[model samples]
Target: MSIIGKCIGATVMAIAGASMAAGDPTGATASPQALALLGGLATAVSGNLAHEAYNKLGDKFGPLIFARYPEIDRNHHIIIALRLSHLDAVEAILRRFNESRSSDHDRERQEEAERVSELIKTYLREAKRFQGDTKGGRALEEREVLAALPKAFETALADRSGATPDVQAARHETEAQVLAELNRQIGSDLPPLFIRVFSGSESGQDGWYDLFVRAAASRLKDDEAFKSIWSAEQLSRIVHMLSLTAGKIDRVLDGQVIAAQDAERRHDEQIALQRRILETLSTEKGVPASELSPILERLLGHVDVPIADVPTVLANAVDGLLAKSKTLVAIHNDYPEIDRAINEARNKLKTLDIEGALTTIRSAQERQKELQKEQLRAEARLHFEEADILRPLYDHQGVIDALRRGIELDPEKYWQWCALGDEYVAIGERREALNTFNTALQVAQKFSGEREISVCYDRIGDMRQAGGDTAGALEAHQAGLEIARTLAERDPSNVDWQRDLSISHNKIGDIRKAGGDTAGALEAYQASLDIRKTLAER
Candidate 1:
């Protein structure tokens, strides 16, 4: 824009800023609002003036003024820097000129240039182009043009300037067109991936989209198409990553719910188990055992529970029918055997085996049979208590079995796969354990549960090794290790990954040994051991 045009535009912006800053009754905070409005108006006016100058005086005239002034040449530099939307540059120029304290004319000129530079810089900064075919964007280096005004004004703004009209219009039109096209490209792209590829239960990611847009625009320095396509591609990657992340998050959330449910189930079972044992220990009329005691005892971890607190269902337990809360604080300490007897009596309660229990109790007095008799009494009592309490859980066998069955029915469900794998671990069933891990992996590949995926692969390697497919097992283990490595790199700060990586390395080492690659195996073991040591210290 011409020096005259900028002055006119600045005047209009100043008027608007003054009015708003005067405190209109609308209650909007005035300073920022005025600043914002002033910046916008100034940019618009400058744009119009530049367009006009491009049309009237040709591209080179009144567009610059004080830039050419010999004494004011430095201010022109400040002007251009400001035009480039660099406030720091403008401030820097002001500091240099203002501190010099030269003649009044120089100071006045410097101040005017600084004010103009500041307003333009502020607008350019606020007008950051984050999206469009322009990608990293192309802003008018308007400050550059204005900065030239001090020097160039002598010739360009002269009454009979030497520049031509056609040349000027062409330059302005082309530059404006490029900037507009870039923005257009960005707003038009990116919708297809947003809709089709993202389907997690909780999937609304506008902020992510915004970041992609900024990155895309940043890449568009040379060509519009490149930036536009770059943005679209980035958008796709972000969506895919988000989908994977969301799926993993859901798995954890689901697991938490299942954990709570399982704990509740166990606690209820324990209570039922204990109640039956209690009922069985009571004698035929109302008498308790003369010197009652059961050798076999089940102990849950200690808890800080209030003695007066009502029995509440616990969240986790063993032996489906044990009453952890009741047994802990509520039980009588003086008659400690009462607790043991009650537990022992439950095993035989369902069988109505009063005769057997009495005989077992008598045998406890004999030195040779003392421990044996107590063990028998305890087992018998447990069986009776378990029988009745087991009914409800057994009744839901269809669902439990269904889940169990599904674990095999589809190897892809990590929850199911992990379940069957755990069962195999308990029974020393290596073959089944290997099979279960395979099932786990099938489901895991479709999502981002790398922890379980690594587990499944490790098990597969183990199975393959047992079956004498040593090379194949080694390959599988290596693949698992590679997967862990990739996950760790992607999330560099995840501490748990250290352990996961270590375990994977150990598996790799073992696989290498089985394949007759002793050296490789040693390296793998060393790596795993090192990671393990680090984790231990942490």
Candidate 2:
């Protein structure tokens, strides 16, 4: 095994052994010292490991600790420090503990010393990523160092109760020195950004903001201005609430940035579409190039009109343009390019060839039918665009109406069928939704990609699952999974297909777990995790 692998194995065994040795059978009574040492060991092991490795270690060990110690889970300062990779704070914790026990010379003490030394060596070996050691003054330095300091200090003083007066005095002096430094770094007053709590799930985070607030309050509590109005506990609560509010504000700002980006993207697409429309009008509809600019400017103003009026607006505009183009044709010509067919039929009539004339008429009817179909398809496209606009507004009825209109005009559009089915689901019409989805499945199987067919199956599975039909849901998901597997195997380099395969596995796992098929669920979940792990590695 590699050096890091060996370190991981040793660390896990050591922690597990300690927990097992605890008198409490549940490992619930493991001493704070043991848990702190465990955290210190984690900090050391994760110092040299990749972020993925760090998370994996946490996932493996966090539950064992949290299940027995819910309070630690609630106030997970050490976990936050690990996440930040704040070497200074974590190292301080270990150094303080080791310093307090330095005079002990027992065999167990020596062994503990050896382990701590090895762990510190492991941590310092890759010290370049640590704060102040990074080469290029990397822009992102961890602030959780400051946030983790209070917990570090608290852990350091955990053994103060049994210490001699001199030792206790020394610890108190160290605390004052650290608090003074903290007060200097963090200002006396909290910022206005943290005045309100986050909109959803206040205090629901894994105690990250709570830890931050505690660190800030630990320093601020000594401030003369803050001390005048608020007690220590009240100050802590206020700071915690403010931090949550700051998080909410940050999320709102992020959403605004995303919305701006999306709007710009849509604007670009609209410009391209408008350019194509203008080009078609100039070349195909015989509109003069000089007149196109003014006509386009007028048409652009109509975009402000409501979504329901879009199809009618589009049809009227196009029909008026077509009428204008038709008037430009010669008076004698009822249809462009039909003159030859008319001439042929007249010649046959003159020759008394009634059968040939009838054949020409039938051909003309077929041509008219093709033109009518083309017109219907054009109208359908307008309705589809209307549906797209309505979707974001959550006007489900409008979307259903528009999609249904489009489907009526062009039944071959399989995606429209699927979309219509989704709208049916939104309206709580399960029977109609199922029938529509089945129709979509049939259409998708006939003409769409296998991916779409799989999507249909997944949707059907969701519906069945919601209706207490676990077996049916599993069957449908398994069908989708088979298709996804095939697609992924066919093109191993395609990230999308690989992701689809993983999603299929996860869905299957969920269904099996719901149905009490624990073994099958585990197998499916493992397969999904394997794919996701490979993807993450890449």
Candidate 3:
């Protein structure tokens, strides 16, 4: 089996091995390719070769491979073998890729661990800074730790990533360690305010606002010396300022958390695309690396394209290949008779007959071009069929892009322009929507009939109303009503045009009412009611 094939088989086997160890049966039957790859791996040399194969697979597939097959013993064996083989370059690359793919939550766990360690160091430093002045230093030490306590608690409890059992345990361990040191250093010395704020069982209770409120209330009520130093008004001002500051801090933290989550989501999407590309390349049995490289490069480049556009972009690429294939088919049809002459020339070249060989070689070259063209045409047709199959799977943005392309291809199609305008409106790009509607209206004036012109004006009026331009909306509606009135007068039997005129009158009435012109509004509503009564009777 090929190296690529072996990688796929090994991946399946590795996953199956993990499942078996966990007392679960492999849920589905393995594919023939997977079985073959597995068989190849089993029959191959053990230690170095097996490890090298696994390393190459991991290098290509990244951390997702190890995550799926997380058997520690197997991982250890591979690492030992890799080291013995002295494949430092491969080892380093795989290590970097794996670390990059490891759960970001684990990294965040480590960060919390480091933060608590640093807090301990800082506390020790602060303790030593006032080593000899124990009487005065006690209050300063309590204040310093109180100020740092919120951050330490935040590190322990803030939602950094997925809080699995392991993550929770790690966080709890760090929180306990930090709290223990804090209690040991200043637990006895802390006032009732400090104990009330930080002694809660939950980490989130250590927030500065809660701490400030409790501390202030305690000092104001119990400490008569504290009361003599400050007025009630002064205390109220301090609490108010603290509340405002805490509120601002909470908003900034919320924004940062949201931005971080969005970044992580994008990163996961990119990793998924990479895994798909790797899996696809591994499964293609006989495709040469040279031929595959360009396809792989293009797929990698497209990883950054918005997910909605990927399907359409891929389909269009296939269409381009199909067009090239059609050109080849035409060439093949024009050169049907050159093959036999080329074969004869090749036979003469064996006898050192240079002139005959040259003539036959030229004929053969022409025939080869024709054959190549035929092959390309066949491949192109297959690609075209595949693209068609994938068309329905494209998303809303893909559909919009395709529609826009269609409009560009047939610029004179006023209806397509109108359709694109509507799509733009659906997506909330009001500026683009208005521009598209105006463009459609311009085209309608030259190539379309009065109904199309009336529809354009109606759509423009709606957009203006949505934008809060009541006067502009009224003007556009009036223009549409004028066209509708003309069309209705020209063809009295056209109910659609008459209905449109009534709609315009109602819209004008709404605008007049909103602008506080009750008399004008009443007249417009009366006109609309008259049209509706006439239509209802008909």
Which has the greatest lDDT?
A: 2
Ordered by lDDT, highest first, the candidates read 2, 3, 1
Which window of ten consecutive residues has the lowest lDDT sum in model 2?
191-200
Minimal lDDT window, size 10, model 3: 39-48
At residue 108, what lDDT does model 1 achieve?
Answer: 45
Q: What value does the lDDT take at residue 489 in candidate 1?
A: 75
Off by over 4 Å in 3: 1-395
- Indicate the residue-level lDDT of 164 in model 3: 19
lDDT of 3 by residue, 21-42 (tens): 2222323343332322222222
Error of model 3, residue 478, in angstroms: 0.9
Better TM-score candidate (1, 2):
2
Clashes of 2: 1
Question: Whole-model Cα lDDT per candidate?
Answer: 0.44, 0.55, 0.50
lDDT measured at residue 193 in model 3 versus the true structure, 0 to 100: 30
Q: Write model 2 residue lDDT over 284-387, tens digit each, in one string.
A: 64655444554455556775865445434544665564443333323255575565565666555443344565577567766877899999999999999999
lDDT of 1 at 89: 30
